[model samples]
Target: MSIYLTAILKSKKDKIQDLKSILDNMVLNTKKEEACEKYELQQSLDDEAVFIFHEIWKSKEGLDAHNQQPYIQEFVEKVPDLLEKPAEIYLAKLV
Candidate 1:
């Protein structure tokens, strides 16, 4: 089964741009990773304060590798300070 994740982030008014910037960088870098099947950042059309990340990895190990990547760690650390609420990350297995 493929590994998938949906992450929701609600950015503070002042950090919306910063959140986008960071996510943009992470998306670009993620595409280069061996385990990344798909990595996308989406802005909420109805709510400008919301950002969504859709990610697909090759396997559980691949997802783990992605989590351990330095930039991923950095991105995770940066999100809390940039958001109005804590970011929510969901992990799923393709059926």
Candidate 2:
């Protein structure tokens, strides 16, 4: 079955633009993966520093592979300094 993921990221007050640029690169690179079904980046209207990633993959394996990608790893390594808090991630399936 397809796997769905939602990740919420909150950038530090001064790092929002930098975080957005990094995330934009991640989105571009991630969408090229063969197992990726959908990938989207959303910024909150009420909070400029809050961003969300909505993703769909072919299967759990696919998502796992995605997690291991270099771009993803780079994002993980870089986010701590840029974020206000730890990212929140949810894994789910379509109802």
Candidate 3:
């Protein structure tokens, strides 16, 4: 079964561009994964500091593998200093 994930990330003051650059790189790399069904990044029109990700993975194991990726780890390491708060993530399945 596929897994759906949505993540919301908020940037710290003056860090929108920096965070966006990182997110853009994430999208670039993540989309290349064989198990990635979808990986979309969107910026908020109302708030420049807010960014959102919509993703679908082929399986939970695939997502688990994605979490272990070096690029993902790098992004996580940068989160504390660049973000306003920890990322808010939601998981869903089709009813």
Best candidate according to lDDT: 2
Extract clashing residue pairs from model 2: none
Which of the two candidates, 1 or 3, achieves a greater lDDT against the reference?
Answer: 3
Q: What digit string (tens of lDDT, one per residue) describes model 1 on residues 1-95?
A: 78999999999998888988888888888899998999988999998889999999899988888888888899878877999988898999856
Rate residue 37 of model 3 by lDDT.
97
Candidate 2 whole-model C-alpha lDDT, 0 to 1: 0.95
- How close to the true structure is residue 4 of candidate 1, measured as C-alpha lDDT? 91
lDDT of 3 by residue, 1-95 (tens): 99999999999979988988889989999999989999999989999899999999999999999999988999989888999999999999888
Q: How many pairs of residues collide in each model?
A: 0, 0, 0
lDDT of 2 by residue, 10-90 (tens): 999999999999999999999999999999999999999999999999999989898899988999899999999999999
Q: Give every collision pair in model 1.
A: none
Local distance difference test, candidate 3: 0.93
What does candidate 2 score on TM?
0.96
**RMSD, candidate 2, Å:** 0.7
Q: Which residue pairs show backbone clashes in model 3?
A: none
Question: What lDDT does each candidate get?
Answer: 0.88, 0.95, 0.93
Query: Where is model 3 more than 4 Å wrong at Cα?
Result: none
Deviation in Å, model 1, residue 1 alpha carbon: 2.3
